[model samples]
Target: SRLQIVCWTVLVISAYLVILFIRFLNAATITDPFNITIDWHLWALLGLSASSAVGAPVIASAKAAKEPAPLQQITADGPRIDTSRYPAPVTKAAAAFSRTEAEVAATGSGVLYGKAAPADARFTDIFQGDELNNAMYVDVHKTQMFLFTVIAIVGYGALILNMFLTTTNPASLGLPAVSDGLVAILAVSQATFLAGTGVTNTPT
Candidate 1:
């Protein structure tokens, strides 16, 4: 749920940035034939997109199954206890205990115990059962968003580095120039993250 909230928050921020980007494109003119203008706001948008991409799978991994009640289960059938073999005092104590309590006592000391919570929610683990298929499907999308974000970061970083090294203007070094193709890539990455998460259009 927190991850969903974060996704929604990022969505809202991106929507505002989209409006700003469109306005900038309409009013501003690009003088350089080789360089394209990209603002700090767009960079901020890309960062947010990357963050959302990486967070999705982590959130899914944290949604562990509820821990079952104590003594309700044991990982194995448990060790056998011979009531007749026990000393008089031990036998007396065992006789008064309830079945559940007795079961716990017998198995609790052994190596076998209840299963631990899942360390991560892998797709296969969630997908095998019909009840968890929806969650599995969602996680798959989240994984895609994560991969996209990683690629965007690498590509965007390379472009920025190129601009910094090649350009003379201070503004170019700071805001940098992005190719039309790179711009499309960044836009699509953001959109993919938003769509995969089903984030609302409304700004927060």
Candidate 2:
């Protein structure tokens, strides 16, 4: 969700810069170079993205605070337990190996604390589940949000480019108007993404 907001922001800023450049090139003197008209739909799209970006983390954090501590098991060698509630391992073998080490380190000390640091992050993490049990699975909400964001960026970019190419007045060229439908689609996608973050399949 944050990435999507950054993409839209970059697109809008780039377009705005290009418009300003065109205005400078066409005129010798301008009173207000930064006075570019922005359509309300564009603002609405930005607001939606910003709201989702902010709300997702708040929702996830709240959910995490309410989750129960992870369950563990004791063994002859050491403590053996699932680490899914902690940071995820990069691979199944790594997870197994970590568990073995934990078992070996167990000295019948009933106290256990600390969490594993997350492995090197990957772009694929965006589409994967947040909870450890389903971390390897694809998240439909994230996938849909990603798809819609890409579509909006591409569609809006093309519209702006087409407008620039066909406009008779470069000095008057403002940001291209976004359609209500595209904004609506993005709004829905962001809402679902936030909703998905608030939900977890972890057994209570």
lDDT of each: 0.41, 0.71
Enumerate residue pairs that collide in model 1: none
**lDDT at 81, model 1:** 42
Worst 10 residues of 1 by lDDT: 127-136
Put down candidate 2 lDDT per residue, 150-174, tens digits, no spaces: 9889988999989888998765789
Leading candidate by lDDT: 2
Highest TM-score scorer = 2
- Per-residue accuracy of model 1 over 1-204 as CA lDDT, tens digit each: 234335435544554454345445544443332343446556655565555556644433332221213322233568644434432221232343332435423432221121123553443532121111122123444455455555654565565556546755432324433455655655665566545444211111
TM-score per candidate:
0.32, 0.75
Q: State the lDDT at 162 in candidate 2.
A: 92
Query: What is the Cα-based lDDT of residue 189 in candidate 1?
Result: 56
Q: Which ten residues in a row have the lowest lDDT in candidate 2?
A: 105-114
Clashing pairs in 2: none
